[model samples]
Target: DWVNLEAHELNIPKDESTKNEAHWNCTLKNRTVKVLRRWLNERATYDKYQDRDELWLTKKATPYSSKSCNYLLTRLIEEGDVPIPEHKEITWYSIRHGVATHWANHVGPHHAKEQLRHKSVTTTMKYLHSDSEMRSTAVEQIW
Candidate 1:
């Protein structure tokens, strides 16, 4: 829980809708932990619901729903002056897919599957995609 503040990991509670039947622990990157700690400190100064397990809250003092979270991400992307391609839209799941693709390409599908916490590697393969560089390298090696 956010209230406990573990040094290097965050506990994710299970959600049946997402197929997560048991709680899982995600180890954080060093930079992520630092950033989260700083945010928690700042959040503590203003958030009235300090006793709540949620790490984030809305202006109305409620936990953010997934839709609201995505809206906030879009707003942040816009406010940060990030450009979006003509026919593409970025959402939270797309960002996750990008990460999964990166891991699958650079590390391996098995490692990517473990990182994604998927019960089966088949599901992880859906996010794995071959980029131009990888395709070029494969052709070179085959020739």
Candidate 2:
């Protein structure tokens, strides 16, 4: 329901698809906390709906729908001049998968499952990606 700046955690509300779900606490890294703080300060300067319960608001002080979020992300990427490889696409799910993969690689699948809030490790495995480099490293370690 709220973000705890001191704890560096946010409460993620359960969506309609989540069965028997309550809120989940997602821990934020220090860098994420810093960025969020900066965003809050900056947004307050120009946002008329500062008192609104919604975390994100458009310039017109309206809540952002999924489509608007996608548009905003695309616009930001273009305006920021971020380069994308040919045939490559970036979406919110890309970031989610990246985070899930990082946890699965560095730690373990059980940990990744927790990080991703998946009910099963099998579900978490779908987000993990293994490249040639990782395969090579594993083969070398075995030999």
Candidate 3:
């Protein structure tokens, strides 16, 4: 698959969101573009690709599944020496949830809802994590 660098966006045919939200537009910045450039070069040289349309492929050149993505993340975390507590858990959905919480905090719940393309704000709220201390500080500052 080819990336349209000039447009500075990645067109995803499908996403984890609802059915109507089929097309997900991922914005690409300069840093991401640089990494993509290197990856594209590697993809071109990789054997067994067989002219596939998929952006990500395995050593066998098949399309990467959600399972593989999760596995890869685990391996990367271990390699990067990121600490994880025994009780804590991490998954692809967790990353998405964290982003949703961040968006809700910085902008507004409605903005996060729109960005996630959820059917309702209630659904978006399920993905967010609250910070009581932050809320307390904000309330104190309001006086």
Top candidate when judged by lDDT against the true structure: 2
Q: For residues 1-143, could you state the per-residue lDDT of candidate 3 as single tens digits?
A: 23676677676565543555566666677999888878878878866664676778877667777788888889988999999899887777788898899889989899888777676999999999997877999999997
> Pick by TM-score: which candidate is best?
1
Give the clashing pairs for model 2: none
Assess each prediction's global lDDT (C-alpha) against the native. 0.80, 0.80, 0.78
Per-residue CA lDDT of candidate 1, range 47-121, in tens? 476777667789888878878888998999899999899888888778889888998998898888877888889
Question: Candidate 2 lDDT, tens digit per residue, 6-111?
Answer: 8998877777224426666778999999999897777778647557767778777788886787787788899999998989878766878989988988898898
TM-score on alpha carbons, each prediction: 0.81, 0.78, 0.76
The local lDDT score (0 to 100) that residue 69 gets in candidate 2 is 78
Off by over 4 Å in 2: 14-20, 41-47
Please say which candidate is ahead in lDDT: 1 or 3: 1
Say which prediction, candidate 2 or candidate 3, comes out ahead on lDDT. Answer: 2
> Order of all candidates by TM-score, from best down to worst?
1, 2, 3
* Model 2 collision count: 0
Candidate 2 structure, TM-score to reference: 0.78
